[model samples]
Target chain A: MNYEVHNWGLNVGNVEITGVASSSIFLIGDNETIKLTSFYDTPPDSYIVGSLVPLRHPTIEEGTDNG
Target chain B: MDKRVAHIGKTRINSIAYSSMFEIGDANTFTPTSRVIAVQKEGGVETDEGFEFDQYELFSQEPSNVPDSLTVQQKNYHHNPNIHVENIDVKGISASSIAQLGSLNHIDSVSRIKHIRILEKEQNQNDLIE
Candidate 1:
């Protein structure tokens, strides 16, 4: 199944697809989206994962990996 | 710090362990036949703990009291996580309800709905609330 999540406020968008239940694709930053797939199998009990690509400022990046 | 965790390409979750873990200080309401999370581990109903809701008990509270069409969401926060709030299960919940809850953090949505149903269910078992 394909799910398209649109935010009413933030321009951020998320698209999740089944079949590969392991990871999900997310769009972060302006014009520069980030895709986190199979990044972390077992999410940490309480810790930050994932990082911002390059072009965008590090602050505008995400922390968690599991979707 | 509100967090956002999503599958890079896939929208579905991998494990059921990290289901819904809503934090306190969220928006939620309840009414007769109106479903809401009944039980919370830390915060009260005033604050949204992102608690998951139990559907069976929600409807059972007043099965005859027809369900109403409503919308419930969390208040805006400076730091919000990319939470996935959707009822994966084909629960008795109406589609609109799911969508409303789906807009917020995954954990909060579930807790808000499931918690109440769970409480009501237990009440029924003990003959507490009719």
Candidate 2:
């Protein structure tokens, strides 16, 4: 594997990203071989409480009323 | 790899999911495998039941080095993987996500994401029928 990546002159303005999720890649230009693997298990508070799914928080204190 | 001149303005990406990619130009191979099990439940419930648990068997196995990055052996490469981005404003790119502008040779993208959110708790009922 021998190479040259002379990716020249890239102008940019205002690249705002809220999210690029999981196995993510944002390439502007030039690539040979790229591989990405991501496994995300959100463990803020792992709660797997079943039995007709009953766990609410008063609609987030009655603000959004998110159903 | 040779690429030149990429101009971008006001490129706002709100969301790009799973095997996510937002490319402008020039690509040979981009293998993406994104797995996310996000569970945020404070006041939102929309079924999926946590995918019946088991923690996804840790990405459903199949990780023995992926053939050692496709049996790495290639040289004397050529590049035209082009890109000319002037202006782009994206809102959402979902699942097997890829939003390209120009130039691609061979690409293999893989996306597997499972987001489960279910919130409920506070049931106090006492003898009522009306």
Q: Report residue B98 deviation for candidate 1 (angstroms).
A: 14
For model 1, residues A1-67, the per-residue Cα lDDT tens digits are 3333443433224433332122221113211112221111121322445532324334544874524
Q: Report the lDDT tens digits of candidate 2 across residue range B11-123.
A: 66666655466776555665655455666677764775645545676667654565454354444223433344556666776555566554454555555555654557633
TM-score of chain A of 1: 0.17
Model 2: per-residue Cα lDDT over A3-50, one tens digit each:
333443344544544444444445554445555454444543345453
Q: How big is the positional error of residue B33 in model 1, measured in Å on the Cα after superposition?
A: 24
DockQ values per model: 0.02, 0.08
The local distance difference test score of model 1 is: 0.28
User: Which portions of model 2 miss their true places by more than 4 Å?
Assistant: A1-67, B1-19, B43-54, B61-88, B94-96, B122-130
In candidate 1 chain A, where is summed lDDT lowest over 10 consecutive residues? A30-39
Clashing pairs in model 2?
A: A54-B120, A54-B121, A55-B119, A55-B120, A55-B121, A56-B120, A56-B121, B26-B81
Give me candidate 1's TM-score against the actual structure: 0.14
What lDDT is obtained when candidate 2 is compared to the true structure? 0.52
Shift in Å, residue A21, candidate 2? 8.6
